[model samples]
Target: MDSLTHLTNNIPWQRLTTAYGRGTDIPQLIETGQYEELSSLIEHQSTLWQTTPWVLMILLQELSKQKPEQVSLQEIQLYTAVASTINVDEMDSQHAVETMNELLDEKYLWPEDEEDDELWWEEEEPRGYDQEAFSSYFSYSYLLLKDAIPVFTAIMEENDKLAPAIQELLLMLQSEGERAVE
Candidate 1:
């Protein structure tokens, strides 16, 4: 089996949180060719989730296996959405993992009762924004996508249909600005 299959089998998708809820259905959705729903679950209003990078990794792996002409429109759109969601111009990939690790160490907190809807409703006040957690989440996902630049680059070269958008993404990642990962 390929690496994507291996990862799909091994990763704890049920424990990963997405916009709506746990990512228990993600692997099944991918297996059933549900790209649109997958897109919605992995990202919401530009926020990436714990599952986003893994999902994208699998999708990219599938894309790599297909002939350029055989790539589906849904797949293209999913990747385009990813490109739009990430502001790679602001990232420092070399240090992203370190920063993510530090932030995660400081800010990784999940409520113990995730499935308790009544408990959620019992909370009178919403939680405050945790910037460190947000930054760590973004940085981790960004690094994962950044590491797939070679795959994206190869697709850009071979798939004329996706080249322009992928080119823009590549440009954003390759920019020399000194901005730290946000």
Candidate 2:
């Protein structure tokens, strides 16, 4: 438990498997591909907003840079379409999450009583995804991965203290992501 918390405090996503492996010795589950628990564990621990999202984004960015030949078609489209739309360079996770909600999920507070022809609007407000805090959260994640995703990857892969091979597939995907070029 304490070890998991320590691993959670560090981000880039690659370290999760190692953290798990260290605690549990069942590396075969990774080989068998029963990794849903791994994902669930991550999400469960991340209710407070984890930097794994940035790890994902970094992998995407790296993928976009690398093997353009093998990049996911969606990645290409997203990079082409939303790259310019989003101010990623200046985007803080808080603002980004909030903006994401605003642009994607607009919330409308509805009145109790409904009218046939006449419409009643009670309140329309932005469901802020608590944007002020995650800004620094993402910034910290960026700093963690600035060196290379593999820095964390190596740590996870080699750390016998962690479940070592837990996120084997995700690490594989992220490793494949290194194909991006400058």
Candidate 3:
């Protein structure tokens, strides 16, 4: 896995949309280890955004590396709470993830190319926050977390205090994964 710095630098934070607005501040906050502010930006009132999964991934990595007693309760709470919001609907997300992956490949999250001399005309379309797209985004976020299950599993084994929460999250992820395939 890439170091948090590498992942933080490589993602197009300016282009990615978060719950509060553009994700321009995310990299700075992450580098500074300001997760409380980070949480507010990616998740709002149980709604997740394009930045949520990526931030959560980074948080998981950081949390798993820390000594169990040193883990931030706030960060753990944020991780599990944000996770509870991921509801993958019946959108064929296996296919959506493929589509999203292709989009990421082509820099779909970046500003679209245009010959417009007008700045307003060149403005990027809003990150699709509509119903279907939101479902797809949720599905995409679910899969990202699903990929990190082992990280949680390892953390569970090492931390007695955190095991119950991590186990609950594992159960949630497992059930969600099963539902995605059904």
- Please list the residue runs of candidate 1 whose C-alpha ends up more than 4 Å from where it truly belongs after superposition: 1-3, 93-114, 117-130, 172-182
Which sections of candidate 2 miss by over 4 Å?
A: 1-88, 91-129, 150-181
Candidate 2: deviation at residue 148, Å?
Answer: 3.8
- For all predicted structures, in order, the TM-scores are 0.70, 0.24, 0.70
Q: Could you give me the TM-score of model 2 versus the true structure?
A: 0.24
Total clashing residue pairs per candidate?
0, 12, 0
- Top candidate on TM-score is 3
**For candidate 2, lDDT tens digit of each residue in 1-182?**
44333433333232122212211322233223333433332223323123233333444344434432333333322222222222234543334333322221223212223341132212232121234433433434333334344433443344444323323322332322353531
For all candidates in order, the CA lDDT equals 0.65, 0.32, 0.66
Residue pairs clashing in model 3 are none
lDDT of 1: 0.65
Segments of candidate 3 deviating more than 4 angstroms = 88-95, 99-125, 130-133, 176-182
Scored against the true structure, residue 18 in model 1 reaches a CA lDDT of 71
